[model samples]
Target: MTSFGIATAPQQVEYADVLRVWREADEVPEIEHAWLFDHLLPIAGDPDGPIFEGWTLLSALAARTRRLRLGLLVTSNRFRPPAMLAKIATTVDAVSGGRLDFGIGVGSRPSHPLARREYAAHGLPFHDTGRATDSLDEALTVIERLWTEDAPFDFHGEYVHLDGAYGNPKPARRPPIMIGGRARATLRVVAKHADLWNIPGGDLADCVARSRMLDDYCAEIGRDPAAITRSLHLGVSYDAPEATREAIDAAVAAGFSHIVLGLPAPWPGGVARWVADELVNRSPAHRGT
Candidate 1:
């Protein structure tokens, strides 16, 4: 059965909104998880907006929530070094008692000058698709090494090189790696790395076509397509329970097993209750992890 999670926008300044959603997730039996956008600023280009940094929020959430799994919908590979990020993920996994779903990806806003400016300020490389994918490939390798390797080793790669690479604590368990994107290179990375593939462009026919394409990529790499869970990230209204259920049903029909909804802001408590009470249980989709 299709699972449901809420992906809250960070651009909005409501600290209450983030807490509210987690609170609802705690109260609702159907919400499998909750996510945050990993952006530094509002995508709407508002510089003054209060975009709570995702990792910090995630850390606090790890300490706060008991049942809801937490993570970024797709954190950019450009922001932090993968080795450092691995430590962060491991720490969160421990704090959350092994409920972290590590979702990551290439950048989302390629043309935003503000983002580019920030990248430059941080000394992070903002390369073209090929270079970025190369870096991500290397980053995933490093991240996995840090999580899995007990002995110190050397990580020599095209983008990042480290001597005596080691990561401790190893996450209560290695969290599931979720990679999101639809680019040819991105899909290749997803096929090679992701435990859950969050497909972009969430139309039914488009999702079906893309899933088939992803299956081909998996086969090319000698992987079982079913080994990776299929997820669709979308902006579906929870303002009405019936409408939301309709959207979820459609996604499931298109072969998406996990559904992450980006709810509209101005948090509606009543709508949330509707989902908790009326919709999620009514759906035949399997209860998600």
Candidate 2:
């Protein structure tokens, strides 16, 4: 069955509005999970628009909601050291009673000028995709060890180095890892580490091709391709429900089972239930309901 989720990017949106939508979604069985993005600056709207920090906002949302599993859509490995991120994720997992899906990836690429500016604004070094992917590979290794290892350990990687690293109170349960990206290098990492792999929806053929590459990578590693859930992030259309439903149908038909509807900001009242009825229920996957 296809599981549905909602992603509310914090850019140009009010905290109360996001909270309200999440609270409503918590009561709706159709929406099983929720997500926030990790950009420090507004990628959309005015340059000076207010944008909340993703992990901090996620922690607050975790405390306020009961049923929804939540996490950032994809945390930037460049933003924080892996050890610190692991600790932060552990706290959120404990707060949400072990309902975190740890989504992470290489930070925004240099190709996106808007996204690129934020790194300079925040005094973060924006490395090339090669270096970024290398860092992400190391970050995942360090994060996993921190989450599951019994004793404090040291890691000395090219990008991340840890000395006597340990998580005192681990997550209520270790959260599943969700890695988002469509690049081949990222897919290699996804095949080895991720419990779920996510890519933005638009080019169905491109996404299927990427999935196939991931399958080949998995096979090379002697791991089952089915081990990772294929996830898609399709933008929700407030005015065109049929378009969103068509995208959902196409994604599920291509073997993508985990769907995340990206809701636009300044969310309308009762938007979660609206999404459930207008998009999810109307999709071919939910026909005969």
Candidate 3:
């Protein structure tokens, strides 16, 4: 049997109100995990537009919900230092009673002046794929060591170094590490280290092909393909007046353990409710298998 889950863009609505409603909604027995998106600025539209910090909001959600596991669909490595990110994740996992998974990626924000400005502020050199991926790999190594090692661990990487450093009060459970991206390098990293892989926007056949590719990579690396969980991000529009159950079923047939649907827009009334009902509730047994 499989399970079903939902991932949403961060609450752009009034923070307090959205938190209240999300806390309640997450209590529903059918919802397995409540996911948030990681973006320093809006991926679309104006950069000045309202956008909540993903990790901060997830930390708050950890306190507000009891059962729902919290995580980012994919966090970028360019945003913060690996040690700091590891600390934040550890804190959230402890706060959530060991129910946090750290999903990260090497992707950047969509093209926009404001987005570029924000990236510059973070000292990130956007459009440099090598730099971005190198940073991501180093960050992953640091965070994983922080989560698993008890004694002071020393890391000497090109981008990061630690000299007998220790993370106090480690996460109650070592949060699972998830890496996402369709690039060949990304897939190789997934085969080497990821607990889960999030593949974005593809048809069923595409998904199966990607899954097989990942399996082949894993086998070549002497890793078990079954050890990694596979997930998909499905963009859904509730206003379409028709559910995309066929696509969802196709994803399942391709061995996706989780399908994350993106809501068209955040409206506090019937539209949001309709999306929750028609999309997330379409299948309850296809997640976390």
Judged by whole-model lDDT over C-alpha atoms, candidate 3 comes out at 0.74
Per-residue lDDT of 78-146 in model 2, one digit per residue for the tens? 899889999999999998989999999998977889999988898988888999998899999988988
Query: Per-residue lDDT for 239 in model 1?
Result: 49
The candidate scoring highest on lDDT is: 2
**Residues 182-270, model 1: lDDT tens digits:** 77788888889999988754567877877888899999999999989998876656546677677777788788888887766766775
Indicate the worst ten consecutive residues by lDDT in candidate 2.
280-289
- Candidate 2 structure lDDT: 0.92
Q: Report how far off residue 275 is in candidate 2 (Å).
A: 0.6
Q: Which of the two, 1 or 2, has more lDDT?
A: 2
CA RMSD for every model?
2.4, 1.1, 2.8
Q: What TM-score does structure 1 among the candidates reach?
A: 0.91
What TM-scores do the predictions have? 0.91, 0.98, 0.89
Q: Clashes in model 2: which pairs?
A: none
Off by over 4 Å in 3: 109-117, 268-277, 280-289
Ranking by TM-score: 2, 1, 3
Clashing pairs in 1: 1-285, 1-286
